[model samples]
Target chain A: MQSNQELEGFRVELRDWLEANCPAEMRGGEASESSICWGGKNFEFASDAQRDWMERAASKGYTVPTWPVEYGGAGLNRAQEKIFKEEMDRIGARSPLDSFGIWMLGPALLHFGSHEQKLHYLPPIARGEIRWCQGYSEPGAGSDLASVQTKGEDKGDHWLVNGQKIWTSYADKADWIFALIRTDREAPKHKGISFLLINMEDAGVETRPIKLISGASVFCETFFTDVKVPKHQIVGTENRGWDVAKYLLTHEREMISGGGQGLSGGRALGAVLNESLGEGQEMETTLRADAMRCEVDALATGLTLERYKDQAEAGTGAGDASAMLKYMGTELNKQRHELLMAAGGSDALEWDGPLGNRPADWLRTKANSIEGGTSEVMLSIVSRRVLGLGA
Target chain B: MANLVMTEDETMLADAARGFLDKSAPVKAFRDLRDAGKTHDAKMWKEMADMGWAGVLVPESAGGSDMGHAAAGVLAHEMGKTLVVSPFLSTAVIAATALRNVSDARAEKALAAIATGDVTYALAVDETSKFNPEATSMVATREGNGFRLSGKKTFVVDGALADRLLVLAKTDDGLTLFDIPADRAGITRNAQNMIDARDSARIDFDNVEATGEDVLGQVDSAMSVLKPAIEAGQAALAAEMAGLSAGAFGMTVAYLKERKQFGTVIGNFQALQHRAAHLWCEIEVTASAIVNAGRLLDEDPDNAIMAVSLAKARATSTAQLAVQEGVQMHGGIGMTDAYDIGFYMKRARVGAEWLGDYGYHANQVAKHRGF
Candidate 1:
């Protein structure tokens, strides 16, 4: 860990830089899902400020702060990056850009990608030129992800992809996808897999949006029929995609475990509850108690997350314990929403009122446990990996 | 305010404590103590004192190490792994905290005595309500400059063996704390055998005399002393509970691997594995909670009470579930006294209910949060 004096000095420099560069519109206190910028081909900026924010932050390599500078990152150490985030949060600055490319693909490429692959793929991702969506789960492979049936025939120079992926968040809008494709059909379920990156604009590729209960079309079912992917697009070894998939899943779980941090965009949860419940009115004791416990647990989880981050910075990634964080983090998020719903009462059900947004946000948390990996699967991993239980 | 990682000395202390307990007094030691109708091993208590645990919280000026609450918690956690029945919780933790926080010279003398393993103390705070310290209504009437305590204190842990009793009492001004010899006149102790095979007592304090110098802290401001003492006790208890649950969880996992059923070891079953995994996750969270409490107690004592409650609450419930699953997963043999799993279940129940149960601590957490 850096000395407090060094961190404080860095904070001053970072604060000055952000103040001079961050656009006024981009400093909006909280970001709605629709307001988030996901850059790609045909991507709408929403506002010039949005575009400028992404450009400036990316130019400074703030998009992926902790990654090496060679890969279009600020090359900040964990402590420095944390301090930078704290400064950003202090100003309630909205995230300059949000993309699966940054959260999922960038990490996988850095760890498992070839030097050439990192140079080719990571810079564009850091610059937000391409948006990415995951294709790990097919209709038949929700929880059992390695049992993917998406076959990628081994062509001499390229792979022929033929498969369908379900619950691909933002796949309809994404520029490309990193998918788990079976390269060797005769091998075991896990061994024959390959992680292939394919563009969404390829011929025979199509995506149909899946409407959620919240009436959002954020998710899509994607189909790839003989969409040719270059052999160079493969992430690790030809048939060792499971390893890459697993590694990416760790990052994905870490991202989801961070759901609590993003949900309100740095707004105080109590402020939201107060808006619905009416300030100064006494909340039911039981509900208040439940909220208190949830908040404390959230604080504890936040500390746990920091510990894991520090552990990762120390060169030992959280590994399977990420499952524990994912499990607890999602549950904490659901509980936060549950309390919000309870606080809103009948007003929370209003379709277009101030409290109306609580319902949809609460519903979105339902996927926190199910997506990435189900809570049950997470527990199974915790038991098997962390506890060394079972055969 | 939470220190996630332990200090190097703290980690060394924990390692040494665990290593010593593993060799000197494992679960088999607990078995022998129970079978022999003894709540604690005198030889092991002396060893712990020699290892400087008894005076862990006391200041170095008073012939003690003053390692702070977090280090003491490390040893407490280790002791918890073996279910080592000792006066560490009542005497070293609770009584020593009270002695360390006061200005009285007699308190320093008691601290030196505790350091030398010549004296042990049990805190008498609970009445009929079981674990609530604020429920104390025992009277201590003033006589000249001193006071005379008269009341009944039930559930005084290790009270039967304590050389002195640190009593929480009501005064004309407010609540106060006093430390008096267990052999003092008009103090009658009825020893009770607890379910966990620990020694507890119901004491009737009939006009027990106390000097002005015997007061643990300023009169009517005993909450200051009592609160930290209990917080220290709860932090240690939480760590112990974490240790107990971790131990039980480990034992159950081992049993699942060795105990065969139908055609294969039961551990091969996904159903059992998932349940065990859930328990393991619960234990991890509980362990973190305990660490947070210990760290907060040392780093930020002003707001440490809430973290203490959080730790005790989570550890209480987690240990309960761990012991329950330990027994259920072990089948019929777990129910028998011949197997060690049953002992853990019994010990967990006692530890969970002690100091404060889950509901009590959760309620405190809510109160502290202004809910």
Candidate 2:
């Protein structure tokens, strides 16, 4: 660990570096979902600035700064990583790349995957060369993920996988998937599962985009029919995939909780309200109060995240408290969007044009609680695992 | 005052305060104090003063240990858990904030006296007005070099026992703050019986005399100091409310585990478990808000208002829900006066109303947002 003075110096240098490197266009307001870069085989650049930003960030390993430098990361410690984030936040730098592989699969591979797997898989993720999607929730298993029946039959050197995964976010665009598959049908529900890595382009693999109310198809139903996955593609042991699944779920929840801080890096609610209400808008006192309260809660949620990160760095990792964070974060996100919608008034109801996007984004926040885990499921975990309140 | 992490010193301070309160002034002690017809435990107040809690916000140069509002918040939180009936919030938090915000020789003298447990102070801001601080209608007329104050201040926490009163009054310029001795001539105090049985009074000022030395900060521009000082107080109250809610929630959970019904403990029921889980989440979120408010007070005084209001509003709502559910979950026992859970509900009610209710604070947040 470096001294505080050394870290301070690093921060100054890092701030200057980011300012010099990050394109001016990428340092403005929040980046819309469509503008986000999910590096994959078929990824398209939204703009030159976006492509340039991703290339610059990936070259320096800032996309996955905490990972080992050998795995295309900056290899910064947790404290330095935090400083890096703060500096980026100070300049409102848009995330150069958004990938599940970075948030979920990358961490799992680092912690539980073999050295061979880490070397093979993590660098591509760090470089944003391959985007990944999760294959956790099956049609049969939503909250009861242990009951997943996505089966993978053992065959000498490969596994034949078959089953459908519901709510697979961005599956259509993903290059690969880290999925939970039942390798042993006779074993107990949780014991027979295996975490498998399969290319989305593999034979008999298909994704059907699920159109949402917001008129977006970000979610897809991913199906695997006799899909061949090499034995080495199996993460962890065949019958012990539930462990990897559980670990990955923690990361997934953490990722969803990041939405609590606003996925778009949108302007502050107060700022938005000020613009919408204008100088003489007759905004109701109750509405204003609700907006302010929600804004405060959102800021507090950010602070809470920092506290949990600090605690995690200090060795008291959030553990099941990640459920608490996920629950609070998603709920706060919903509250923020709700207030935004209210501030927009009749204009928020438009279904097209720039003004209509607020309503769409507000509707999008609805998925926050449902995805990762339903708010109810998160609450149950918090009560039983975090608060020790169980029946 | 949102802190992502507490320093080792702060953690130790919080832990020690909690331990002391648990041992010395638990929920049962509140009952004992009431049975003894005492609004506050003077001995405990002195003990807290000895612990340097009274001077937590006072700078070291003013004959006190200079701790940040975050530390004071920790102490306030611990005190709330045990419902430690004292003037600590009024005297230590509000008054100390006023003295610190406006650093004058007279204020420093008062700070010194407060540090040694020799004197106590309360902000007599609320009149027959609404919750707004700017609604103060007390008149302060200039009389030669001095001033004559006359009006009524209602719902002044610990006002009856305070040595000095930070009175908000209307001057020729605008709203002002006057620090006057509580025992000054022509001043009368009457206890107002509250649901929580906490020390509060309605003070009547009948042409009370004050000089230039009595003015805190500027005459009409006291908002510069009073705004942040009152915000600090609000943040402290939010911390206390968070503690009270957590304490109540814990007690309710314990009761659910112990008190069995229909062949097993009722805690086994999914319905109660779900409600308990919801309460736990709410309380945890509110805790985050309180920490944020305290951090803003210590670090970003200029931007502390919104965070303070958020903390107060969230904690107020959370504690209210917890206290109400606490009584309901405990069945018939929770409703009885003999039970400690009932006390939490009463204390939560008073605490919620004292600083500002959820609606009031939330409104302030909205107003700050330019509504």
The best candidate by DockQ is 2
Task: List runs of model 2 lying over 4 Å from the truth.
Answer: A1-12, A24-32, A260-266, A273-281, A284-286, A342-351, A354-360, B1-3, B59-63, B102-106, B300-303, B364-371
User: What lDDT does candidate 2 reach at residue B274?
Assistant: 75
**How well does candidate 1 match the true structure, expressed as C-alpha RMSD?**
3.2
TM-score of 2: 0.93
TM-scores, one per candidate: 0.91, 0.93
Q: What would you estimate as the lDDT of candidate 1? A: 0.84
Native contacts recovered by model 2: 0.56
Looking at model 1 chain B, which ten-residue stretch has the lowest summed lDDT? B1-10
lDDT of 1 by residue, B135-226 (tens): 67899999999999999999898998899999999998889988888999999999897889989999999999999877888989898888
For TM-score, the strongest prediction is 2
| Model 2, C-alpha of A340: deviation from truth (Å) | 3.7
**lDDT values of the candidates?**
0.84, 0.83
The alpha-carbon lDDT assigned to residue A350 of candidate 2 equals 84
